[model samples]
Target chain A: MIAAMTNANPNIRLDKRDLILTKGSEVMLRRGYHGTGVQEIVQAAGIPKGSFYHYFASKEDFAVHALEFLYAPRLQRYAQALGDRSLSPCQRILTFYGELLNHFRRQERPQYHCFIGSLSFEMAEPSQPIGLQVESILQRSVDILAQCLTEAREAGELNAATDCVELAEFIANAWEGTLMRMKAGANAAPLSVFLHQLERLLTPSP
Target chain B: MIAAMTNANPNIRLDKRDLILTKGSEVMLRRGYHGTGVQEIVQAAGIPKGSFYHYFASKEDFAVHALEFLYAPRLQRYAQALGDRSLSPCQRILTFYGELLNHFRRQERPQYHCFIGSLSFEMAEPSQPIGLQVESILQRSVDILAQCLTEAREAGELNAATDCVELAEFIANAWEGTLMRMKAGANAAPLSVFLHQLERLLTPSP
Candidate 1:
């Protein structure tokens, strides 16, 4: 995504902005907002402190843009995963979460839960605008799933009475919680349970 | 609980430690671990800076104890709620979550999701001991729910095929995720969806 963005926009200014956001997101996600400092972000980005100020007025402002930068690709992925036509809509939704759980299992150390979920948890400092942006990203994710669920029901894969929108919201929220547990490290594999329960949820009982 | 603790312990030293934890947990939950400072916690607890150090070796140590203080009451409440015989085992499990959702709805602002969930998300700093402690607390919570689920299945409330342990884990993870969404503020009420889905999962469809 970064390469494509720079290729599409030859502007040095936009390229530098993207560089800072990409590097800034990495640092922020690892260290969290307060744990990170302005100097740390600039150092990580290899940008001058002046350049950082030029792009973002404040750390909070940087976070908003960084979140926007982080979410764009993630939301795109969610749409891609759920909207994949090769799999039936039910499989697409189920497989999407299943694959994510696999990715979590492969991690060497406990990685952060979904960055956006962590950010929302850490965002107790009360930035209204940032809160609004996070809310929008969360909705977009749920909507992407909702679309696939709508397809599943239309295809007779799901029961006719299922509320696609509500199911989408529940799945999205549950998936976030699953990610939360993935980091906390439970005695039993939450994803296996999540996938098992999800299969039960999507498939009718005999 | 605090009242009971104080009544049981007449030691002045223990009383001071309890006061610090009570006040410290309140601040930590509201402001978060990194957001809060030792001095601020001292002020909140009305103890001297020297006294704060007397109780805890470091901020991280303070957080661990605070988490313990925080979880004790919460786990107690969970055990009490799930063990209440006035409700059937199925209703005990389902209604515990439903009531929690209603409580979330009553919140004036986006209160933090369960503190443990938030800390696990925020705990990206690689505190192995803290991580293990959180994991154990999570398991204890799951076990409490699992015991209730086992009873439900034994009482013929849930399907015979139900895996109570797995279901308990999934519900705990999903509920944590549901709380994550609760703070994010989605278009739909997650708790209602969570409750709706929980009902379906617990009660077999004819």
Candidate 2:
């Protein structure tokens, strides 16, 4: 949707829009939504303040787009992992989380599952629009995982009695909680706990 | 420590300090840390800006005290629940969460598990002092639960093979994740799943 808008305005350079969003999200991720300012983000991106307004209607609008901007490729990767045929359904889920853990482990500090977790936490109350966007994004992720879990159950890898959507919601919520802890402690031990428990959580029922 | 300071300085009124913290935390919870200002907090507190400074050295300092202030009574209640003699150890753990869920359910809004959860989400990266305080609070909670699980094991209610501390951390992290979801969706369904999964997660291993 935003891409259409960018293309419609021939004056708006894709690179510049991307630059503002990239820098804006980085600052927002580091300092949080309320912690960041439009001028600061424009400065970080080496763009004029006017250019930010040219591309975005308001700080809130920028955030809504920033969220979609940050999520697009990552969601693609997530969707791909969920549907990967090379691995069994259960294997796909575990391996996906394992790779994510390794990514966070390399940082040696709390990462926000790429900042969406924090934005959602920060936005949910203050800005209804962004909160709605964040919730929708979360639901998208949950839907992806639920689809994978559904396959797992059908393939006899998950418990036949399992409700895939509910389980997916639990795993996603649990992972979000683990990220909150990781941020507070600046440690990844909770990530380890998340992964360990993820295995137990996915085991088939008797 | 703060109580001692209050007693030593007859100039400072306990009720005034409490007012600032109570109002400050409420604003901070509704607005992200960076979203709020000392002026706004003081105005809401119905106190002079000087009063806020007298009790708290800085915004960071105020947040640290606020974190401590918000946590004190809740921690006391948590310790009580963990050590509650009427219920079995596992029952104590589950009942504690059940009661908390009911509290959030009554509000019809996503709550912070009493604001500490959101503060931890917001404070960790931007402010070191507050982050450390939040981590310590989380550690305290995890410790209480771990102690309860230890008793549960001793009473033969838990799987003997269970690593009580690790499991406690997982449960704590998972509950935090659950709360994050609750805040995002403004729904209590996640809480039900947390309770359901808590039972399964706590079940003795084969």
Candidate 3:
């Protein structure tokens, strides 16, 4: 599907920018940053090769923006989910997993979760700059969740002894690893089982 | 540093088969399955495209072998680590993480944790056959660890009430996620800290 390009920088004439990023995101999410070709992006976006160069200085430039474009809203949803007043901290965290499981089951059939993570791993081998951008994007989300855990602890909603930073990192990684296992597993039980065990971990024993 | 390729199969010609798989392993590890080009693999292997096709019917065939090539040793080491009779089951598990942490620190400079979980994420989208191969590799490792955990429980090495399957899954994921965060953080402490916490979880509290 060709999404119409929206210009974020009018002075820069980024008319084809959004189209490139959208198409590129699809390809990269399916493939990966190190594995994708600008030619493929141009072909997928239905833009000329020359037009791709005109819109972005290089493939790396487009990928950095694409990572943000692909991940920003997902991170926002994460923040919102963590802040949900109607749910307990533990419930909200599990709800985030539920939402992700729903995404995995979608007809579009995304094979993985966390593009920032995928790119971080693929790019870590070669490109320092790209790896940093992806890591910062992930860390930002981790920081937000850590803050939520802090708030939950203060509200007497979590065990006071729980280390919020470690817990946040744990939840982030559990989700990340769960997605990988889910895609790799022939069955879906791994995802739900991980979540159930996580709930058991977070819930205080009476 | 280029390593000489050794053929594991006697029926296959050693030089040609090793050339394709060794180079293919590097490309897939560095770029991922879909992101890598057949041309790139052939060039790196210094084999003609025809020679490449002579050994493997398709990229999928090459990828299946590459996935196996990448993970087979790691799996062997994991089994050895679990089967070491000198160490208690809990200590064996801790030693496994310790050994993995050393590998992470050593290769953290050059993006060392190559295949296993990394490629699993990248190929999750396009390479179903390769994905299955990787999944089976992971599942087999998890099964081995689960068995160790079961032994630990039966031998009274852990709390009799400890859920072996869940704990094994958690330990496996902690390593996967910790590698990513440590890579992102550019520090090894997170990996060690996770191992420490895991040991605490595994120990029998009086």
Q: How many residue pairs clash in each candidate?
A: 1, 1, 1
User: Which regions of candidate 1 are displaced past 4 Å?
Assistant: A1-10, A108-110, A186-188, B1-10, B186-188
Candidate 2 clashes between residue pairs 3 or more apart in a chain or in different chains: A177-B177
The sequence of per-residue lDDT tens digits that candidate 3 reaches over residues A1-206 is: 22324544563454467778888788877767766788889999998899888867888888778888888888898899989989877778778877766666663544445576777777754777677777778688889889888877777777788788877777676666666677666446667667776776666544
**Docking outcome class, model 1:** medium
RMSD in order of candidates: 3.3, 2.7, 4.9
Best-matching candidate per TM-score: 2
lDDT (tens digit, per residue) of candidate 1 on A38-152? 9989999998999899889998899888888888998898898888899999999888878877776776664653567667777733666667778888889889988998999
lDDT string, candidate 3, B128-160, tens digits? 787789778877888889999999998898888
**CA lDDT, every model vs. true structure:** 0.79, 0.84, 0.75
Q: What are the per-residue Cα lDDT tens digits for candidate 1 across B1-206?
A: 45546665547777798899888877766665666789889999998899999879988888788788779888999999999999999898878887777776776664653568657777734676566778888889999999999999898998788888998988888888777777766322778889998888888666
Q: Which candidate is the best by DockQ?
A: 2
User: What is the C-alpha DockQ of each candidate?
Assistant: 0.56, 0.60, 0.46
Off by over 4 Å in 2: A1-12, A110-114, B1-12, B110-114
